[model samples]
Target chain A: MDKVKLGKEQLKELKYFIYSRGFREPEVMMEILDHFACKVEDKLTENPLLSLQDAIKEAHKEFGYNGFYSIKASLDVFTRRRYKRIYWQEVKKILLSPINLLILLLIGLCVYHSMKWAYNNGFYDSYFNRNIVSSLIILIVVCTELIKFIMLPRNNGRSYHISIANTVNYGNFFLFWFFFPSRKLHSVNEILVISIIAVLCSVYYYITTLAHYKMIKAAHKDYDDFKVLVENENPLQ
Target chain B: MEQNQFVKGSLATIILKLLEDNGRMYGYEMTKAVKDITANRMNITEAALYPALHKMVADGVLSATTELVDGRVRKYYSLTKKGKKETANKISALRDALESVQLILTPKIANG
Candidate 1:
């Protein structure tokens, strides 16, 4: 038997039904709608006399007791894991690449030299002077975060995954304030350790910023692709 | 007796095998494929299939893409390179496990 395909209006109704069922996340909704639509189509094929509503109900019944919640939950978990994977992969790639490692070493050297100069100049003897490096780092992070917030993607129907991935956690940077050396530098080892910490922080910020923009760009492309698909299907509607 | 538990244990391997045979498949198609392959004796239910698929995708063992199909956007899952390698290992391991179980089930007879 040939499969009975649903019309656009029927698909819309199915989407609404799923939305009513609380799977509102666009990505999640898309997956659930597709799966639900397939079942409904199967139902229609099995019983051609069935009404769309009845077919929908019958299709929904196949989801069993827990219904779509379990599917949504799983998808949510997958989205988060995928985001984390993308983030860490980029970080690892940047951290491990030979050229990047060389660049990081250069950055560490610059930080060490600057701090050594400040220490030799007796900059750390003053309370305010000791905090200059940490203060500068905190200021740059804050400003970058502010800029990111201001330039957030304007797309309305973005997936929760994108939104969650887009968020920059500032909590990690809070440790910078506490760990920063506040007293006069005692030895070269202290200077070396601080420089390494500074370089690590900078690299962390760099990779996260890179990942943030990458996600936004991908999200925009995804949004455009879906929009085109919808427009193609509803050309004259 | 229905062996949903047995099927559940090997669901990931079963899916990997299916995707290995069929390049790309949607959720409903996978459930149907399992049923057809099992001659309707076993079934892969919705509650079980989606979560497993999503988990595999998360683990980089599978990848999902969406396409417009029959007036709806269908999410199709396929194996990644990692997934392909994993499929081989999983299938071999599962086969070994099944062989061991078969060994246990086949009672030893007195030496004649």
Candidate 2:
């Protein structure tokens, strides 16, 4: 068969090989194969000793399948490293940002003042005041904001999703704090409802974190596979 | 080997040069061309390749078109006017670096 005329079976095999090895771009893979075939055909016309299959095998040997994968892997590393570097740079900028720092300080002062006011008003001692609940609500909001600030630098698909879920969780916690009757909540039924909401929030946080962790793990695996391919293909060249 | 390290930094220059010569190329074709030209000495990673291409597109250094080929969508990248100018600048920069390095390494002898 003509080297230029790559059969469907060969194309399919090449595609599957690339995909199974974790190359995500199908178009790029096809283009590469087509280019390779063309080059081989050109080389064959000049020197007939280089059969199409032989040319392909030689080409493949020159650019080992694993080596190609490694390049992909190294690129992943480069991206992640670049992302991380950019993220930290952004974080440093955010930390140094006067407006952001001022907002955080203002919020901190407001919470502190509110806690002091609650104490002065004897809300902590009285059952009807709900000062403890309000304080808890403020604490949750502050922590949620802090979590968001920390996650902002690392923000990508997984981090973005996590931040959203955290926001929702905080919102639910706020609702439960304001609406749930603390005055009549000495009963078991009230306590059960509060406990369930708490449990639900805890579960949500666990699940979200777990999901993010799993995603990062998968990315790391793909990265490692890519690295292996590069090392195999270009061994100290 | 140190020259190999410069490959990453010079990738944009290399891509621009190739496009200058070839007029246009898709992602895989560009990569294959680089590999062939380098005689497989340098392997361009797909992950690095796409992001760089995308960034160049975003930066207006290159223009892209998506076309259906063999029942799949392929994105072709071609140099814009900005890309051509930038390529010229890169070539000049490379030439200057080569000259400077050669000047520094060349042995100076007393005039006879």
Candidate 3:
């Protein structure tokens, strides 16, 4: 049996079929497309009498009822968990670094003593004002990350779901302000509690920003690999 | 086709061994190679293979390079330095395990 090849239009249609089957990531889409195409061609070549469409259908059936969809689901879960694990590892390393260790020490001392100083100055009500700044900072950081993630060109990488999930989860922030508007501080102790929270928020923001940057870099690397792969396959381009 | 859990247990070594022998191979190529080598007795599903490849890639045991082949982006995976060393270790370990299993499977007379 001679080798049978798919046309450009057929390739596009094959891509659509993969996409419609629930593979949104171009990284996953490309891999599955190659696998599906190869199996279909192999089927056609062996049978010799089967049409291209029939071979494709037969190949899809071979993937079983779940097919690439289950692979996509498994991939999503694995990548998300992997990103989180990487983020936590980096966070641990960052906190253990000499500079960050010192910074955290300073942040702890400063937040505690600052609250005491404000209380000594008769600024008990100022905790609300301090919290407002922290709240707004959180909102701005969330919005900035959301915009960055949204502005990313479509189909960047396989594992960016964690970063995007971070932004999506920020929707809870609005409900927070809506429900906690009356949360007030009446003492230096209360102010100290808020300060600890504020400091933790900042630390979280720092780590997320780092993770997002790493993800973007990863996305670029994977997408670039894919682009080169596509370009290499079609020398006519 | 349903697969033997034994195959799943040895997937990493199998993959590393393949890459070591073949230089580099894409996802489907690896699956077809296994099937062809086993005369279709072994089949690795897409679900099993891709995640394993990604895991190896994530772990820095395998390095993936992509290239276009017939308008398809094929990700070819090859062993890294770490992967090469691990492959040797796994091969030895698998050999020992197989020997033990072989002894278990071999028949002997029931009476002493």
Candidate 4:
């Protein structure tokens, strides 16, 4: 059978149904709208006599007593879970990838030797100086991500994934922040080990920032796709 | 015997294997395909099917692409490379499970 196409008004009504259900996230909205429309059309074909409204009702019922809300719920959980996976994948790449390995080694060696240099020069002799530098570096990394978020356009297709990815940047920030005051700073080994950790904190921040950058790029692509699709569907618009 | 639990448990594998054979399928097409293949004996409800599809997409076991077809934007799902490998694993594991179940469900009269 040829497809029983929906009218523009019917499509608007479908959009209203999806919007009213609180699925305002652009990606989620697009996915759900397309999926629901496909199901609604399937219903209409199975019963040629059924009106669009009737078919929509039947299709919604196929989602069970909970209706499309259940699918939305699944999507919500899946979104968070997916972002978490992305965060770890990006982190693993930075920590283990051969390309990043040399950088990591360089940073580690630099920090280790600098701490030794400072200790011999008496810069590390002051507790206030030691904590102040670590604290400032952590603050700077966190601030940079926040600043980028503020600078991006409001319609950047920002989503939970971006925030999740940024959170990975802060993964080791608290470790150094809280661990600084309690450290046994009497020995060369102790201070050098702490300096290596400082380098790791910076690396962690870099990984998260890059992941967030990729997500933002993807968001722009999605928005562009939606724009082209909309223009194609309604030429006058 | 009816196998609602069996069908439910094997849903991911069933979907993966179907996509492996068919190349690409949409949500409605999948339900109909299942109905046709089983001659209406088994039905994969929308509730079960959509969640599975979305989960597979999230897990990278499947990839979804959208195209305007029949004057409607239909999201099509197909196996990713990971999904193809997973399909093979699931098929073999399911086969092993079915054999184990068959051993208990039936027995030769006297080793014929």
Best by TM-score: 1
Superposed model 4: Cα runs more than 4 Å off: A1-3, A46-49, A96-99, A119-132, A135-139, A150-166, A170-175, A182-193, A215-237, B58-60, B70-72, B85-89, B92-103, B106-112
Task: Give one digit per residue, the lDDT tens place, for model 4 in A1-237.
Answer: 887667767777777777776765555655666667877877787788998877877777766677666666666666566666665677676777887778767766765666556555555324455644564565676687578768644453434344444454445456656655433366767777777777776665566666665555544565567555553423221
True contacts kept of each: 0.79, 0.06, 0.66, 0.47
Per-residue error for B2 in candidate 2, Å, reads 8.3
- Tell me the tens digit of each residue's lDDT in model 2 across B1-112: 5655677777888889999999989877887798899898887755457667757876679987655454233557899999999999998998898799898999988799
List candidate 2 segments past 4 Å from native.
A1-10, A20-59, A74-116, A122-237, B1-10, B20-23, B31-67, B72-75, B78-86, B102-112
lDDT of 2 by residue, A115-137 (tens): 44544444542644455645465
List pairs with backbone clashes in candidate 3: A229-B67, A229-B68, A233-B68
**TM-scores of chain B alone in all candidate structures, in the order given:** 0.96, 0.85, 0.91, 0.92
* Global fold similarity of model 2 (TM-score): 0.45
DockQ ranking of the models? 1, 3, 4, 2
Clash number by candidate, in order: 0, 8, 3, 0
lDDT of 2 at B56: 80
User: What interface-residue Cα RMSD does candidate 1 give after superposition?
Assistant: 1.3
Off by over 4 Å in 3: A20-25, A96-110, A124-159, A166-201, A220-237, B1-3, B109-112
Candidate 4: residue B22 lDDT (0-100)? 97
Ten contiguous residues with the weakest lDDT in model 1 chain B: B65-74
Candidates' chain A TM-scores? 0.79, 0.41, 0.68, 0.70
lDDT of 1: 0.77
Summarize candidate 3's per-residue lDDT along A1-237 as a digit string, tens digits.
477777787777677777777775665676578889888878877888887667778889988778888667655666676666665666677767898777767765665465455545544334464344444544666687588657755553454444456343345344334432334456766766666665565555555555555555555564565565564322222
